[model samples]
Target: MTRSESVRRAGIENKPSSAEMDNIYYTAQQLDTKLLSASIIGWE
Candidate 1:
């Protein structure tokens, strides 16, 4: 029941590193409008 045995059973070849799992992603905002048209028009 060593770390190598646990990793082999998971079947991903290797588990994801902590940095990869905890990484942050950024999304861009587009086309701001009034009267709630932004979401309705799929601008965001």
Candidate 2:
């Protein structure tokens, strides 16, 4: 499977699994960090 597909599958498998195993949440946080960095650069 593709990387995105794997991540999606991991998300599905993570729900109702446990907070410690939430790949989607971690991925979203990482994405947020990148977005924040981009926005900061745009402001400069």
Total backbone collisions for each predicted model: 0, 0
Expressed as tens digits, the lDDT of each residue in 1-44 for candidate 2 is 88768878778542345665587689889999999999989943
lDDT agreement with native, every candidate: 0.56, 0.75
Candidate 2: residue 7 lDDT (0-100): 77
Task: Name the runs in model 1 displaced over 4 angstroms.
Answer: 14-44
TM-score of each: 0.27, 0.49
The numbered model that scores best in TM-score is: 2
Query: lDDT of candidate 2?
Result: 0.75
Candidate 1 per-residue lDDT, tens place, 1-25, comes to 9887888988758655777555421
